[model samples]
Target: MGDDGPAARPNILVIMFDQLTPGALGCYGNRVTHAPTIDRLAREGVVFDAAYSNSPLCTPARYCMMTGRLPSATRGYDNAAYLPSTIPTMAHYARAGGYRTVLDGKMHFVGPDQLHGFEERRTTDIYPADFGWTPDWLRPDERIDWWFHNMDSVTRAGVAEVTNQLLFDDEVGHQGVRALHDLARDDDPRPWLLVVSFTHPHDPYVTRGRYWDLYEGADIPLPEISAADVPLDPHTARLRRVSAMDEVRINPDDVRNARRAYYGNISYLDEWTARLTATLGALGVADDTVVMLLADHGDMLGERGLWYKMNFFEGSARVPLIVHAPKRFSPKRVAAPVSLVDVLPTVTDLVGAAAPAPVDPLAGRSLIDLCAGDPTVEREVVGEYMGEGAIAPIVMIRRGDLKYVHSPVDPDQLYDLAVDPHERVNLAADSAWSAQVKAFREQVDRDWDMDALHTDVLADQARRRLVDSALRTGRVTPWEYTPPADGSGQYMRNHLDLNEVERTARFPR
Candidate 1:
């Protein structure tokens, strides 16, 4: 904001979406769906080909990006998991380095401390910030119908001009546009970091008629792999029971409608992308802004007969990561594997900010080198899931061309992406790749104590359940954020000079 010329610290804009997979975008090789704005960013930016959500669930994956730590380290194992106030986030780091940090939409933060270091949170979160959604590992067979996702999102998918998600995202976009205008007018000397996160194309697949008609009569592709095509592993079988997929009779139409609605929402988000970036250009700050786009996690969208996220499958785990800063770096595609945890370090590196050494050491390495076209950067990504549909902790390590999934209760799964991209065959049991699988097994053993992690998750779940039950018995005080109103000082208030206010508010004056 100051007159530091080319040496001025760049403003950072992070645009994030929920339950969006790389396969849904045109730049990621989806020919059916239309997302021209995002495609333009990818065409003129650094695109990471194999970026994944460290944890496939919403809250855990978000926490991983916010703290640069894993669920095991942060104890943020589920949707209701709490992130302690002590953990320093990218917001805290940016604010410390003389930046105004603001959050416009959903971060899925749980517990009493909602704004974990954000200077200004523009909107209240869409999801509950309490422990009501905690998963009960003690009763693994019991399903909480109120909170658990079911086939209703698929079977009842269609055109809707209004939905709870649509309403929330609309406000998020409006607030983002207003925030940019306010930032342009503010007298604060510090550069700003704005996070405009949208919860879209996530679930309850529905969209407006205009977006829905974009794919009308267009042949939509079905899932390449079906549940019947391969034998179900223990985890996949558990997921089926958890989502109540076995109860519903899904026909071809149900899958088609759901995919259509999901694609429509993708276009909706693309529109917002165009709006926000265009606002930056109108404010004459586009050249000094670093725009990065990513997602909390990916949706299965009925891929492999799975919907929503909570697994290590490519559809659920892989996310779109693109950094559009032609002024800072060249446009190129990096094939190296990365994950959500790397976001914190990468952002800090980009803005020349500092994230103090965390209590639990950060599990991510900075991707700035990879964005700069360094071929020797690490290509490893680690993932963990200890949330619902699991009786034990499951972990995944993707390195080079192979992905290894391990859980104490289920059989190991090994897939070589170089050969079998769809993961149809499980090479874990094959004697030919025994040595590589053995190496992966040993690495898992050294990296994690699965038994201990399982016990810890169970114990935390019990504590949260007990606390939630006790709190619901009396007058409940909700933890949801409520933004403050500043009506007295806004617009043409008599407290300030009216002419000065008008002069500052008018852009391009």
Candidate 2:
């Protein structure tokens, strides 16, 4: 940690969207997506060409990004896995360093510990807050179609005036803008850290009528790996079962409509990001704010015949990361590989705050130099998947132009991304690449004890299921996280609500 001065520290705003793959953006070389706002930010900011989520699922990925620790070490094995409240997150460190930290949207916390260290959390989570989503390793082939992912989201995708995800995101945006207004007006001297997370572009592959019309009759991008050419890897075949892909028959029309709606949803998210950034300018704090944007994980978007995130394919793991702080860092593209786990350290670096003293030491470093267009040497991006689609601990290592995926039960995969960008060829078992595969396997063994970790994960799942069953005796099933005094404490931004603000402020007079 380095301290410049109290006043020198800038306010940090993190805009995180769900399931956004970087390649789909206009700045990332896609010519069809209508996301001009994000493209503008990429032009003005430091764009990481190879940024990934260390954990390629929703809950585990957020936990890893929050704590700068690996999923296994944090006990964040699955979506329903509870992150112990004692784990000191970045918000806690920021607060200790004299920053007002706030969260305004989804984090997908499964247990009762909602606010890890945020001073304020607005807009309760769109997903559940209990162990209802916990997966059982004993039943590997059983498809939990009731809640687990399915093709229905893709098969029945289209336009709508409003949706479950749209309303939640609208509220998230409303509260986020209001929170910014309040922070601007408040007399607090500390710097601020506001994370505005959104749940859009995630599911049901739908958007509003306005955004849906943006891509009317547009030629949607189909799967890169065609149906006939899709080589079935072991892990991918498992995902097919977990997602129930075989249960439904999806035609080319379904693919076109789903891709159209997904692209439309990205445009809507771009509009949301624009609104937040425009508000920063409107409040006259644009110059003193440092804005960063990334996603927890990425959507396959029908790439390689995959829909959503589960494996460590570039489509599912790689995400967009852009950091814009014109006063502190230069604007350029960094081609080195980075991870979401670096965010905590990056924020601490930007604000001159010391890293949090955690139960386990951090494995991430700050991206300050990378933002200055200087990248580290020998950058290797590492990620793990203990969520769904696997019974064993799945690990992946990406260094240079090569990506290595390893698991005990599945066949090892090695791909030279520079030569074969689509990962169509696996050089794992080839004798010519035996040295690379051997080195990567040795690293995996040193990094994790797969057999012990597997048993521990099973035990942890059993304990959680027992607790869930006992709690369901008299308590509500599928507990939702609704914060106290929801929406009643929001600040007034419009003239229609001015009297309400005044009335609430002048109470007991």
Candidate 3:
């Protein structure tokens, strides 16, 4: 550990993945995937077994985590939802607390203000920053084929040495390594926070031959509950059409191949995780840094006829959370449910940083106490989805062993995870659980005005659509981020003294 004084703040490295589910990780009990680095981290860190994404979509989930608020509070309704520049993020708080904040990869920021609060952003986002992906609840049945997920990702899954996603993640990994080396050499006095996020194991499920060959003879199991096994719910039925599942015919071979590729990509990310952690160790910052691993949300991966995330099913919403700070926290597994919204506050607490008084009440409390095994902390997780899969707001509350999902249009669902871990039975309809159902419904009524939220979502969608149309009409300036580079600052520059330049460039000074 560093000095106990207030001036000695530890660096924080947050390694995040896209659409990574706990079910696929070996630490979380999947025997097939090869993630030794992650497994080792699990052994040394505090693991939250029931961690979930507050929102299942990309933009809203990232926004909620960054702001320590829920989707509705930020008005981050969907993929194209705009986050106003005025909102304070985790980076803002870290910077305010005298830490150097940096982001090395994808954050899915969906507006012109790309650098939310980071002092430096090392890579451009993988997804677009425009409002072109805004969902219209008015036309709930239509699928935006151009951008919406489809069966093609599964039907065409295979091994590839280089893919768009792979290339992006390669750069993400390289930049993160380079940033750590640079930070080690720099004379900056402040502790640093670097978010090394990757866009992989997400979809189109392709991986390098090296990674794919790792699972050559391994047994890849199919989904426990297949589409043919159970009837689809209303939201999943809508997701099926949204993702164009009905238009394509997927055989068992396609499913197996896709699963194999997904597992391989996970191995590929494991390799990156090794690289980042190794760099931290080589830089001699391993002990003085706190490492966190999590994901924005989980991929359904052909669970119950679903592929991508949209609903609050355990497969889609459950994320893997590991906080590795052995010197500061003892290793333990926390079965209590936690959510992505808790990230900002937790990071603040981990670094001993003081966040500015929040503009609004934070939806999350610090998990540091819980990481240290404090039992008095509440064990509840709240989630809301105003994304493409539904016409109305869907809210979820996970308390103790029960998970209750509610929406105005569809029938409510209640699952007792203690006894029925697979969520096979819906206790909401059982006469014996009527009181429990009513309590959840009343809690929903007390917390969310579903009707008002629906109206607000529709209005926001209309406004964004109008703005998108106007922007596309003429000489369009894209909101897509392009990283800046200064050519004159390259090696052996004409303006610098040769000896000093070489001395400064070399490490181990």
lDDT, candidate 2, at 139: 81
List TM-score per model, in order.
0.98, 0.93, 0.97
lDDT (0 to 1) per candidate: 0.91, 0.86, 0.90
Q: Which candidate leads the pack in lDDT? A: 1
Measured on C-alpha atoms, candidate 3 has an lDDT of 0.90
Tens-digit lDDT track of model 3 for 24-66: 9999999999999999999999999999999999899999899
lDDT of 1 by residue, 227-312 (tens): 88877999988899999998989888999999999999999999999999999999998878889999999988877888898999
Residue pairs in candidate 1 whose N, alpha carbon or C atoms collide under 3 angstroms = none
lDDT of 2 by residue, 1-509 (tens): 13452246789999999988888888888888899889999888999998999989999999988988888888898888899988888898888878999999999977777888899888799988888778888888878767899998899999888889999999999999988877876767677999999987898898788888998777777787864575798899999889988788888889888888888889988988999999988877777899999999998878777889988999899999999876677679888889988998888886683434455687677888788766445577888888878888899898989999988999999999999988888999899999999999999989899999899889988998898888888956555667667355466665457866766444122
Ranking 1 against 2 by TM-score, winner: 1
Alpha-carbon RMSD to native, per candidate: 1.5, 3.9, 1.5
Order of candidate numbers by TM-score, starting with the best: 1, 3, 2
Q: How high is the lDDT of residue 166 in model 3?
A: 95
**What's the CA error at residue 214 for candidate 1, in Å?**
1.1
Candidate 1 vs 2: which has more lDDT:
1
